[model samples]
Target: MAQARCPLPSLLLVLVAVVLLVPRAAGYPWQVCGNTGSFTANSTYQANLALLAIALPKNISSSPDLFATTIVGAIPELVSALALCRGDANATTCSACLVTAFQDVQNVCSLDRSAAIYYDPCILYYSNDDSFLSSADNVASASTNRINLRNVTSDPARFNRLVGALVNATAEYAAYNSTRRYASGEADFDQEYPKVYSWAQCTPDLTPAQCRVCLAGIIAEMPRLFTDRVGGRVLGIRCSYRYEVFSFLNSPVMVQLAAESGNSGSPTPAMGPTSVTPSAAGGGEY
Candidate 1:
């Protein structure tokens, strides 16, 4: 018989030391696996593993309320957590990004028990202990697209206009948005092509006001952290902000965030990135 295909984004194996994950045509975002480990055979360990795997994202579609249910049921635990980065990202891209992060947790954390994953547009968290629910207090994670800005200081006026709009619009969107939990926009500059392409988002679970607080914290750090030639950003479990001179998001987001929205307040003199404690975990490290 043809192999029974694994339909969802899952790794399944039974009665043996093995793993089988169906190839996802989609791509996942840039994620970090905070920590994770392999399981030895035993009733207790198996039960714990199952509990953490209680409800993956695909299952949520069938029972949307499952996310907030009790974390324990008999011996099985249900502490799964998943967040989409930006709706503009495609299913394939998101899938690929997630898989990359999953691999990290599996590889480095082969011995550790707790695990976390970070994707450019999403985050997946699971553990045998803490249920991260209602914990908007986790610290932030940061990274850059690795590309520099085209010409921020070199071409001051145009660069200022582009950055100003993105910083402002994204802050507003995160403060008040929908299931997408995202905001993105662009602005024109006098020197080069469309001056900027930008995007921002927070996990939907956060209240509108809470989202604002989280994103604002990140924005406050941009000036000094901001690289004049390349795109840079600070990513966190609750929120993320990013932009590039070139289009980097899905079509819808690309259209919206790359439209050259005009300038905002006078550009504050760029400052330095202050020291902020990095979250104990960004992506899991073995």
Candidate 2:
């Protein structure tokens, strides 16, 4: 018996459909889940999650801080969730980020009762418990690009110092001055290191003091964590900081922040050309 083979074009279309239908692997820079417990399928927890996942993103768009949270269902099956988009993200970008986040959280955490997913543009976290809202979790996590710096700078230590200064200043502004609890700016070292761009953010829910503590913790750990990497970010559930020689943020937003923070001298225009090679680093939680 001879079996008829499918046409090449038909086979190609079938393959494309299968690829599109497969749940994407986590695209987060880092993800962490709690070991507290797991929710049963077709249960109250899952149902509440279904609702919160849909509502939070929409709610965040109306807030000035681009942050939203919700508590759904009753005790024992309750799901508390939150989403925070990058401070510079517009409403459209924020919505899209959360949509992708909703899928990633479900795919990566699966049955975990508590989970946090960090993307370059947003952060999503959920749990059965409500403590996450007030706990001021200072736990820190880092994802560093393992690749060595491509163009070596003669005085690595000096360059590192300049980077630290830029990030530290931005962190301070984010914690104490920015109403949105976010700030970003650029530093130039007279073409020695070209342009160094940096951004820092803290969850708006935190008090200024708590935000400062969280930002300082991660900033202090950056040198040890990123080392010689050209670009990397240190993240905490409450705070995060990222920097590179290139710009990945909205220019107008960053310039406005710098002006308000009295750092208006920092360049707002794009400096030369730059590129970033997405890293395939794994997740870590502190």
Candidate 3:
């Protein structure tokens, strides 16, 4: 029974209900706020920053960068946004997701100088300063894109073993692969099904070691038992990890390249201890 085929949920149907009813419950999962407090910055400086971020995704929109600048906001924090469609999604679907994330985040965050938002479909974020290209913010957050799981849950230990194998392999690939700091692929687990489909990505500036550390930190969250579905993620300023039964992007190739150019080493600020944790049981999953 656990091995039965599970269909993909209607992202649109569920997302609409989730946004109207339980959006705040998400607690801004992909957030990295510096309680140090956000201060206002120069407007001219922030606009330039936003441009760099929007340019990363070529297929999303030709004039999104221009549209983003038009959205009136305070504080000139540098801004840059990224939207990566799932490897299996078509261009139209990816574009739609980007539009939704962009609009919703604008409403959700309002006028924050430095903020980023990630989605299962894509991500969009900007700050009044260009601090992102060279470094990631310790003030970010993320969560799993929910999906249904099969029989693995019947044996908690076996299910965890599968998640472990997938996340670990992806973490290794992400930390070491300089040409592309992102990796998503399958691995066998419990010798059943594909067992795992894991993904790992780091801010372009982070060193491979840092990416590994971040990925490993999240992978530790796989518990022997299951609750909802077989999906979770750890989003940090420097890197993040995602895993599910399905591939999340529409890229034609198995191993893909991040198209953005330039690799300046930006320093992500230190993530000070927060009472925060990743598990519902409590604490950052790491």
- Top-TM-score structure, candidate number: 2
Candidates' C-alpha lDDT: 0.50, 0.67, 0.47
- Candidates' TM-scores? 0.62, 0.74, 0.53
What ranking emerges by TM-score with the best candidate at the front? 2, 1, 3
Q: TM-score of the candidate numbered 3? A: 0.53
RMSD of each: 13.6, 11.4, 15.1
**Runs with alpha carbons beyond 4 Å of true place in candidate 3:** 1-100, 128-151, 189-194, 224-229, 247-286
After superposition, which runs of candidate 2 have C-alpha atoms over 4 Å from their true positions? 1-29, 139-152, 190-192, 253-286
Better model by TM-score, 1 or 2?
2
Model 1 misplaced regions, further than 4 Å = 1-47, 50-54, 60-80, 90-100, 128-131, 141-153, 157-161, 253-286
lDDT of 1 by residue, 1-286 (tens): 7898764444333422242242211123443434334455554655654543443433433333222222433323333345453555555555554445545554544434445555554555555545456665444322222335455544554465457456556556545544455655555554555456677677667777777677777666666566364476666666777767676765333213233344444444222221111112221110
**Candidate 2 has what TM-score?**
0.74
Task: Estimate candidate 2's alpha-carbon lDDT, on a 0 to 1 scale.
Answer: 0.67
Q: Tens digits of per-residue lDDT for model 3 on 1-286? A: 4686535576677777877775442554243222222444455544454444344443454432111122323343334444444333455655676666555654555445545566654555555443444543333333333334554444444445445544565566555643345656554433344445566666544677766666655555544223324666655445667666555643322222111123322222122221211212211111
